[model samples]
Target chain A: MNKFYKNILGGKAGIIGLAILAVLLLVVLPSSLQIFRLNLVGKYLTYAFVSVGLVLLWGNAGVLSLGQGIFFGLGGYCMAMFLKLEASDPITTKIQSTPGIPDFMDWNQLTALPAIWVPFKSLPFSLFAVVAVPALLAFILGSAMFKRRVGGVYFSVITQAFALILSLGIDGNQGLTGGRNGITDLRTLWGWDIRSESAQYVLYFVCCLLLIGCILVGRFVVSSRMGRLLLAMKDREDRVLFSGYDVASFKVFVYCLSAAMCGIGGALFVLQVGFISPSLVGIVPSIEMVIFAAVGGKMSLLGAVYGTLAVNTGKSLFSENFPQLWLFLMGGLFIAVVMFFPNGLAGLWESARARLSRLSPRSGAAKKIIPMPAMPQASNLVETEPKLP
Target chain B: MLAYSLSEIWSILIMQGFSGLSLFSVLLLMALGLAVIFGQMGVVNLAHGEFMALGAYTVYLSSQLTEAYAPGFAPYYFVFAIGIAFCVAALVGGLVEWGMMRFLYKRPLDTLLATWGLSLIMQQAFRSIFGAREVTPTLPEWLMGSFKPTETIDIPINGVFVMALSLLLTAGVTLFMFRSRIGLRTRATVQNRAMSEAVGINTGLIDRFTFALGCGIAGVAGAAFTTIGSTGPDSGSRYIVDTFLVVVFGGSASMLGTIVSALGIAQTQSISEFFLEGTMGKVTTLMAIVFILMIRPKGLFPSKVRS
Candidate 1:
C-alpha cells in the first residue's frame, strides 16, 4: 500500500493535496455550491491558470512579467471574436447597416468583416488561436528581450508597456475590435446554450479538468532536468551560461509556455463570463495576476489556485460590504506578505509542519526541512599563537 | 495624412511642438523622481504617481482655502501651495519608507507589488476624500491666457510656466545629486552598500531621505500638472506607465538620458497624435520604445559599472 501510494502521489504531502482537490471537485462543489457560486468559482479558476503559469515563469525561471493579462486577454478575445461573429450572422444582424458584421462594426459603419476576424470563423482556427496567438507573441517578445539579456525588473517594465499598448490599441479600434464595452452578448458555442445551468455545470467540470491537467503539466516541467536548469539560472545566470547552456532559449521556452497557459485561461474565461474587453488586457489586471501567483506561494503549483481563490474571494466579500476598505486591506496584504510571508501559504504550511514535528519529536518520520551542510565549528580560520613567531 | 500647404504644415508642426513641450515637462518631472527611486535605488515605487496626485490635491485644497478665507492671497497661493505639497508628500513618503519599504529593499518585485497596493489604497483614499469627480484648481490671473508669436501658433502662459518650473527643478536636482553631501553618500550607498556602511554612512537614513526627496519632486510635478490638467483620483496612474517608460527608455540612472528620452517620447507621441488616431499614435510610440529597448536593452544611455 505504501509503495502504491508512493507511486501514485509521489509523497505524503502530495497525497494530501490530491485528496483536497478530489474533495473540492467530487464532493464539495457538487453538493454545497449552487449554480451561481459554482460559476463564480469557475471564473476564479480561470485566473488560476495565469497564476500556475506565473509559478513556472516567475517562481522557477525568475522572470517577473507584469503583463500576463495580455496573453489572457488575447486568448479571450480570440474566442470572443469567434462567438461574436457566429452570433452576428447575416440572419440575426440583418437589421444592421452591415448585415453580417458584428454589432460594434455595424455601429462604427464597417461594411465587411476585418481581415483578422476572418480566420476566427472556423472553430478549429479560433481554438488554435486561443493557444497559438499568445504563445507566438510571447515567443517574439521573449526572444527580443531575453536574447538581449534584459532580465529582472527591466523585463517586467517592458512587458507592462506591451500590456499598456495592447489595451490602448483595442480601446481605440472600436470598429474592428469591440472597444471599451468589449465583445459581449455571447449566446451559443457550436449551437449549445452556454448560459444554461447544465451547461454551466459542464463548463465547471471542464475547468476543473483543465486545471488538473495544467497542474500535472507544471509538475512534470518543474521536476524535469530543464526545471533544475531554471532554478540554477535563477540563482546564478552567469553560472548557467558558463555551464554551456543557452539560457535565453530556456527563458523564451518557459515564457512562451506560460503565455500559452494564460491564453487557455483567457479563452475559458470568455466562455464562462461571456465577454472579453480591453479593460482586462491592461496594466492593472496584469499586475493583479502577478499578485495572485505571489499570494499562492510562487513555489507551489497547486498553491497558485488556492491563492487566486483566496484573494478573489476576499475581494468579492470585502467589496460587497465595505468597498473603501478593500484597497487598504489588499495593499496591506501585499506589504505584509512580502515583508513577513515571502514564501506565502505553502511556506506557512511547511513551517507549521516543521514546528509540529519538533514538538512531537517523531522518530523515523519524513523530515521536510533538508538540513544544510555545517559550517566550520572554529570561529577563526587561522589561530594566532605567540609561539608561532 | 492630411494634405496642407507647406506654410500650413510648418505652423502645425510648431503648434504640435509647443504642445509636446508641455508633455515633455510633465514626463521629465515624473521621470526624475522615478529615476532616483527605481533607477538609482533599484526600488520600484509604483505609488510615485500618487505622490504627484497628492501635490495636485494640495494645490487644489490651498486654492479653496485662499478663495474662502484669504481672497487677497489667491494670486500668490500657488507658490506657497507647491512648497506645502512637497513637504506633505515627503512626510508621507518618509513614513512609508520607514514603515513598509525599508523591509523589502532586498526584493525588487515585492517592492513593486507593495507599492502598487499602496497606490490602490491612495487612489481609494483620494476618491473618498475628494469625491469621485475630478477637481481643478483655479489658476492665478497672471498664469492665464496665451501668447501667439505667429498667426497660427498660440502658446499658453501656463504651459510656458510649467516648462520653466520643470527646468528649474531639473537643474536643482542635477546639482543636488552631483554636488550635495547627502547625494554623495546616496550614490556611495547605491554603488557599494557594505563599503558605504564601513565608511560610517547611515545607509538607512540615506534611503529614507532619498525616497522622501523623490516623492517631494513628484509632488512638484503634480503641482505643475495642475496648471494644464485637472486633478483626479486615478490621474496619477494614467501617467505612471508613461513616466516609467521615460525613465527606462532614457537609461534608468542617466540624467541626460532621461531628459533626451523624455523629449523624444513626448515629441513622438504628440506629433504622431496630430496625424494619426489618438490610440494609434500612443500605440505607435509604445511599440517604438519596446522595439528600441529590444535592441538597446540597457537603454539609450546605460550607466557604466564593472560586473
Candidate 2:
C-alpha cells in the first residue's frame, strides 16, 4: 500500500497514470515523431536506477552518503572485469594460459593468473561481485559507523575517505586494477555486441524495465513498518535506540541496499559506455553522484531520476555547445537550485501542481498534499538538512 | 648490500628529513584552510583545491606579466603575485559562500554536493583558461641552490625555505585567531552561532571571514607549492583528500587538532614512503587513519557532545 501505487494503481486515475508512463516508455513504437526521444528516455531510465537508491538512502534513511559513485564504480568494474577477461583471453593466452589472464600480466612479468581474479572469468561470478564487494564494504563500514553512534557529517566523511582510499588502492596496484588506464576495448557483453545499435536498444530497454522494478522495490521497502522506523531513526536515533531497536542493523541494511543499487547502475553504465576506470571510482565522481541525487530531489524516488537526467543531460549538451563557460553555467545552476529550489526538480513539480489546484478550490478532484517530515534531523553538521524537533 | 659511508648515510637521512618536513608544511597549509572552512564555517568546500590552483596560476600570470612589463623587477614580482592570488582566492571563497553555500549551511550534505558540482565547473574553467598542461614556476636565483653540510648530503634549500615559511604562516594564523578582535569573533561564531548572534555578533560576516581566511591560506599554499610540484588544473585534487583526512583525523573545529593530525600524517607518509613504495605507503597510512577513526568517530578532539 505504497502512496505511489495508491496514487497510480489502486484507483482508476492510478491506472490512467500507469498507462501514461507505459506510453511514455514506449513512445517510439506508436509514433514515428517520437523516435528521437526513445534513446534519451532509455538513458534517463538507466540514470533513474542510480537515483532510486538515492531516494531510499537520503530520502528515507536520512543518510547523505557522498560516495555512491564508489558503489557504482565497484559494480561497473566488476562487470568490466568479466567482459575484459573474456575479451582479452584471445590475445593473451599465447603468452599466458589462464581464464583471468590479462595483457598487463605479460607487462608485469607474471605468467600465472592472480588468484583473486580467477572466479571473475565466469559471467555469474562477475555479477556476484557487482553485488558482493559493495555490499560487504558497506556492511562493514556502516556497522562500525552506526554502532558507534556516528551519523551525519562524520558518516559522510568516513564514507568519502573509504572511496578515496579504494580508488587510490586500485590505482596503486596497476596489474590488478589495470592502473589508470582501466579496462577498455570492450568487445561485447555476453554474446551481444555493445557497438551494435540493436544491442544498445535492448540494453536501454532493459534499463527502463529495471528502473521500474527498482522503483517498485524502493516503494515496497519504504512503506513497511521497518521503513517507518528507519525514517524515525533519521528524526531521532537516540529515541530509536532507547526504544530497544537495533539502529546499527537498520543502517547497515539500508547502506548495503543503496550500495547494491548503485552497483546495478555501475553495471549498466559500463554496458552503455563500454569503458571503466579508476577515475570513475574516485572521490570526485563519488561526490558527483551525491550531487546528482541532491540536485534531482532528496524526497522521492522519481527525483533521483530527475536529478541525474537533468544534470548529466545538461552537462553533455552544455559542454558540447559552450566548452569555455559550461562550468560557470553549472556552478550558477547549482546555486540557483539550492537557493530557490531546495527540493530540486521534484519540488518544482510539487509547486506547479499546488498552483494549479489552488486556482480552482471548488474542484476537489485532487486534494492538496503536504508531505510529513520522515525523520529526526537535529544533528546535521552545518545546520543544513531538514531538522525536526 | 645497501652499504654506504657514514657521512653518505647522514646526508641521505638529512635530505629525506628536509624533504619530509617540506612535504609536512604543504600538508599543514592545505589542512589548515580545510579545517577553518569546514570547522568554522561548516561548509565542506570541495573546490578548495581549485582555489589553490587559482593561487598558483595567479603567481604564474604575475611572473609572466612582470617579466614582460618590468624586466628589472621581475624576480621580486612573486611577492605581489602571492598577494593578488590570496585576494582573488578569498574573493572566490566569499562569492561561493554568499552565493550557493549561504543557503546550504543548513544541509551539510547539500553543501558537499553543490560545492562538488561547483568543483567540476571550476576544473573545466581552469582547463579552458590556462591550458591543461602543468604550469611550472621558477623560483628566484637566491632560492634555487642547495645547502651542503657534507659532500654526500646536500639538502635542497628550497625545501628548507618552505618549512620555514610554513612555521611562520602557522604562527601568524595562530595570532590572527587568538589575538585579533575579528578572529575571536569568528571562533565564537563557530562555537555557537545562535549564541554569538544573540550577543550582537554579525554571524554572517564571521562566516565570510572564516571562509575567506581559509581560501587565502590555500592560495598561499598554492603559491608555495609551485616551487616543489607542477601546477595543473586537477593538481588541487591531489592534496584535497589528504587535507580532508587531516581535518577529520585531527578533530573538527580544533586548530591544535589540525596541526597535530597534519604533522602526524605527513611524517607517517614520508617515513613509510621511504620504506615502502608510494602506493603501499598511502595504503598503510589510510588504513591507520581508518582504524583510528573507528575508535573515535568524531575524531581525536571533536566537539564535546551536547546534552
Tell me the TM-score that candidate 2 gets on chain A alone: 0.86
Q: On residues A145-204, what C-alpha lDDT tens digit does candidate 1 reach at each position?
A: 899999888899899999999999999999988899999999899999888999989888
In model 2, the clashing pairs are A8-A14, A234-A376, A235-A375, A235-A376, A296-A307, A383-B106, A384-B106, A384-B107, A385-B106, A385-B107
Q: If candidate 2 were superposed on the true structure by all CA atoms, what would the RMSD be? A: 4.4
For candidate 1, list the clashing residue pairs, or say none: none
Q: Write the per-residue lDDT of candidate 2 for residues A1-389, one digit (tens) a residue.
A: 56656632434543553455556565544244243445555555555666778788887888978777788888888998888877776554564544347776656666676887788889988888998988888888888888898778778877887778888888888877787888787877776787677776677777767776676677667765567767878777777766667878888898899888888878887887777888877776776666577677776665677687778878778878977777777766765666677687777777676667768765464363434334433334213422223
TM-score, every prediction: 0.94, 0.90
Could you give the CAPRI-style class of model 1? medium
Tens digit of lDDT per residue, candidate 1, span B94-116?
Answer: 99999999988877887888899
DockQ score of candidate 2? Answer: 0.58
Give one clash count per candidate, in the order shown: 0, 10
Deviating ranges (above 4 Å) for candidate 2: A1-22, A26-45, A88-92, A95-100, A188-197, A360-362, A370-389, B305-307
DockQ, all candidates in order: 0.78, 0.58
Write one digit per residue (lDDT tens) for candidate 2, span B76-162: 777777789889899988887787677788778667667766776778788888898998865577668887776677777777767
Q: lDDT at B252 for candidate 2?
A: 83
